[model samples]
Target: MFINKAFNMKYLSIFSILVFTLFSSCNNPSKTVNPEEILIQRIDSLNKAGYDITDYHAHLKGGLTIEELLEHSRTSGIRYGVAVNCGVGFPVQNDSALSAYYRSMKDYPVYQGMQAEGREWSTLFSADSVALFDYVFTDAMTFFDKEGRRNRLWMKDEVFIDDPEDFMEYLVTQIETILSTEKIDIYVNSSFLPDTLQSKYNELWTNERMQRVVTALKNNNIAMEINSRYKIPSAKFIKLAKAAGVKFTLGTNNTDANLGYLEYGLEMIRECDLKPEDFWKCKK
Candidate 1:
């Protein structure tokens, strides 16, 4: 009787172990939750919220032709605005080149844009040709300081900040000048600071500074770009701009072909409670 009881106990232990193993395997959280599915759900959520998602600053760099870009955009459920940089140093500098660029892009269904690089873009291209594109955008990255030295805010060597206070003032003024003077539809890379002063972003970008930029955009009826690449112009700035009735546009500003969905812009949209009406769209 004792030997039979011990044999039965051993069999019971084996059965328990098998049951535990099966349960754990079936309940594995990692296997049960699919990341791809979650991403798709999030994309669907945005769509349901009436968000007309578009990546307005995509480029055909890194051997990704226009056709491939359109294909990727279609699959990702994002519309694209193809832009050509036209200014003093870029490929399409002169009026003829600008016209040719416009002609080339006219074949595609994508919204054509002209990225006005450098302050000289205003004089380089004619207004008639500039109006042909769907939209135009420029950043405050390049400007001439009071001393007449040209400061390219992105590059460390080219940037000049004499005094933090004075530099902030000048930067805000330059932005205001750009917004008031330039006839661009969207202001890309808004409120971007140089590497030297970027560490103090919160401090340097004070309420007064932000208000100046926001007011300029509002008065000029220009849309601000929510750039995904730099992920800049913080939530505070966006919120303030929104409160002041400034419109916004989403952009990746990609240097390469790998255009991921507008991650940061989408986050800002949710975080800032941006409505469809808050965004700007090209009518034509």
Candidate 2:
């Protein structure tokens, strides 16, 4: 009887080991979730639901050819708005150059955009030339601070922050002035801060400051860009802007060829309860 019991126990132990190995293989980490697949599905669902998703701040930089852009658009299911930087330092400086750029891209199915750089862009480009594009956008990153210093927020060397609070207030005023004065349809790189102040973005960008900027955008009929590169204009700010009836746009603001699928903006859509009607579409 004892011999028979030991033989049965050995078989039972082997059976248990086999079952565990099978379940372990099935639940292996290597068979993990496909985030790319999930992302594609999410985009597909949104597109099917009548969301005209488009990235209105893509650039043709870093060997990113127009043909490549078209192919990416086809595969990604997101449209593009090819913009040329228009200002003193940029390639398209004058009205002639701007017009030529537009003419070159006119036959394409994408929206031609003018990325107005610096405060002097209005002085450089003609109104007729500016009107040639599908839409125009600008950001307050290029502005003079209280010290009369041209503080380009993106440039670490140029940004000056003597007092964080005072600098933030200055930024808010600059945004207000840009919205009120600039002839722009959309504002890209919204709510951006310098590297030093970036970590304290939440603290520096106070309620009053955000409200001021949002009110300016609403009053001037400008759309706010939800930038994917920086993932900025926080959910709180977006919510406030939505409450104030401000429209939103998605932007990759790409510096390279790898133009993402606007993942951050899509996340914002679900988080901030944004709908199709909340987006700003360029009506040509």
Candidate 3:
């Protein structure tokens, strides 16, 4: 495990907490059982089978503190890669801020991740500073449309889809460009679509488009993120990626403190028949 020394000190405590919590739940008079029992069981099974269950896309926004995140890790049995958004308009715009952010999180028991925001992130921070984190990840959600308009896909108002077919081809091209040009470890929020094109996910993300993105990931040696928050990159996409020898990571991309138990990601693991070798681990 690529865990920090401080994390080792707290490992026993976290394990003890999980044991006691489970015991307490079973001791309830009604024995109704906790709803998370299934999730916890799945995590335990996966861990016992040699899988390092982890969440690679977590944030500190929405009043969530590091202590709270650590506590969640203990109970959920999932390690985390806590990231700070860095880009042109983000908080950590320059190397000075990036270094400061790393200092604050270096001692924590979690992997420090940089969520590179826009395409211009290449100019915002130096490669040396970006490499300070355990791993770096980005998405194709922010790109310039053919009209030269900046499109932040998540924001409905900022997304432009003049023609669905044309938009999808352009989106795939942008994704391929990012994978080939950027020095990133993971590609997150894979197969995401704007609000307008969301309903046509299956139609827009055709096999050809999926193959182009998957080929890029495999060629670049980048892991793909199975985003739980968005529940994207349908099972078909995952199976295809796996068939081509592309590894995967689980992510929440949480907006607040509600970091789910990686329900969707776990489902994909089973559906895609992914093995320990099919997952990516950041070696620090």
Candidate 4:
């Protein structure tokens, strides 16, 4: 009887261990989930958070046709405003070219934009032609400085900064002039600094100086662009502008086909806690 009892106890212990193993196997959590799947979930969360992001400054440069861009936009959950650079030295300089450009883009379900290059763009294209585009945008990037010297901030040779203080003042004035003068719906590449003065952006762009530009934008009813490629017009500037009732838009200003979703713009929206109402709307 004792031997039989001991054998029964051993069999019961073996059965208990087998049951636990099967239960654990059935309830095991996966150790690795696909990165793409996680990214999709994150993207869904972003969309849910009420940020209907639209990139207003994408380009079809680098051999990227409109069809290819549309395909990319559909998958990325980003609507695009494909901008054509229209001014002297650009392909779409005159009214005929501008008309053709606008007509060609009619089939695409994207906002067509005119990126006015240089101050001469105002005289180069007539008001009627300019108004045909969904939106028009320009930057203070190329302007005549205080000394009557034309300065293109992007190029090292074209830029001149003798005194940092003087340069900052001049740059601010130039921005205000552009905002007040240009008949642009959006101000692209806002607050861009020359390479020499770029490192001291925060220090140089004081509240007083920023306010001047902000006020100008407000008065002219121009929306500032949060440019992704440059990652410029720092968060501080954006917050200040928002408080001043100046609106903003997201732009990639892509030089190639690979324009990532406005990552920097999204970051600014989160960091600044921007709402949908804070963005500027094009005339639909």
Candidate 5:
């Protein structure tokens, strides 16, 4: 009888351990959750919290058709603004090409954006043709330096960086000019430095310099883009702009079909405490 009792107790202990293990496994949430699901949940939470969550700098390059963009938007839970490059060297340079491009995709649900390139874009496209877009945006990437050399920041050969300090000052002046003179709604690729000076972005973009650009944006009523592709205009710059009541737009500036999720912009929104009111929305 004593042996039988001891055996029964050992079996009971084993059964209890099995039951506890099964219960723990059933209640574990992390084991069943995925990263994509977590991202979607956070996006849904932000949407419910009054954020628009739009990517205003998508491009149709790399065979990225409207159908693919729509599918990506649906899966990611983000709205899109498809942009076309318009300038001297781009595909759509003149007013006729701009109008035809607009007519081709005007029926789509996504917002149409005009990415005005080069300093001569204001002269190339008429105001009436430009006004047809939902919004117009420009960057300081293509500008004539003080030496009268046309510097394209993206192209290594076209860029001329003699003195880093001088280059930063000239770039800041170019940005100020673009914001003040150009009739653009948003300034994409804000605070971009050439690859040479990219590492010194924080050191080069001083408080006074940042204030100068922020002041221009405020004075001209131009929204600054929180570019996810470049992850630019640092958190400090963003906070200063926000404090000065400058509006912002989220952009990807995608050159290919791989439209990355706007991780940097979303992080900035949380870090800088940006609300929906801080963002620029299209009236149309």
Candidate 6:
């Protein structure tokens, strides 16, 4: 009888262990929750709260067609502003080409954007032609340096960084000039540095410099773009600009078909406490 009782006790212990293992397996949190899904849920929650999460710098490069863009917008719950590159080197250089491009996209539901490229864009496109789009925007990327040499920040060959401090000062002045003189509604690629100076962005973009740019945006009534691709204009910059009553727009500035969700811009919205009223919306 004692032996039988001991055998039964061992069997009961094994059964209890099996039951506990099964329960733990069923309740495992890691198995049921995914990080990507959580991020999507958060984005959806923000959308439901009436925030118009739109990307104003989507390009048609890398074979990204309008139909594909529209489908991506529907699935991602993000509105889009399709932009065309307009300048001397780009395909849409003249007013006729610009008008043809606008006419081609007039029937689409997305906002048509004119990405005025290069410093000579003002001379290339007339005011009447510029007014044909929902909005016009430009960046300080293609500005002539103090040496009178044209510098495209993204191109390593074009960018000439002699002194970091001098470069920063020059860039800040160029941004001010663009804001003061250019007839643009938004300034895309705000606070971007060349690859050489990119790592020193925080050290270079001082409080005084940030304030100067913010003041320019406020004075000119131009909105600043929170670019997702470059993830520029740090939270500190955004907060300062917001305090100075500078409006902002979100942009992806995508070069390929894989247009990433505006992760950085959304994070800024939460961190900076940006409201829908602070965004630049198209009247059309």
Over the stretch 1-284, how does candidate 3's per-residue lDDT look in tens digits?
A: 65776788699889999999999887863566575877988998998899999999999988999999999899889999999999988898999999999998999999999999999999989989998999999999999988999999999899998889999999999999999999999999998999888898998888999999999999999999999999988999999999999999999999987887999999988988999999999999
**Listing every candidate in turn, what is its Cα RMSD in Å to the true structure after a full C-alpha superposition?**
3.4, 3.5, 13.6, 4.3, 2.1, 3.1
Model 6 agreement with the true structure over 58-97: per-residue lDDT tens digits: 9988999999999988877788999999997998999999
Evaluate residue 190 in candidate 1 and report its C-alpha lDDT on the 0 to 100 scale: 80
* C-alpha lDDT (0 to 100) for residue 237 of candidate 4: 96
Each prediction's TM-score versus the true structure: 0.88, 0.89, 0.89, 0.86, 0.93, 0.89
Where does candidate 5 clash, by residue pair? none
| Candidate 5 lDDT by residue in tens digits, 239-279 | 99999999999999998898877888988998999999999
lDDT of 1 at 62: 79
Which candidate has the highest TM-score of all? 5
Q: Which stretches of candidate 2 lie over 4 Å from their true place?
A: 1-33
- Give the per-residue Cα lDDT of candidate 5 at 230: 96
lDDT of 2 by residue, 114-204 (tens): 9999999999999999999999999999998777899889998998889898888888888999999999999999999888888998888
Model 5, position 139, has a per-residue lDDT of 95
Report, for every candidate in turn, its global Cα lDDT versus the true structure.
Answer: 0.88, 0.93, 0.93, 0.87, 0.93, 0.91
* Model 4 alpha-carbon miss at residue 125, Å: 0.9
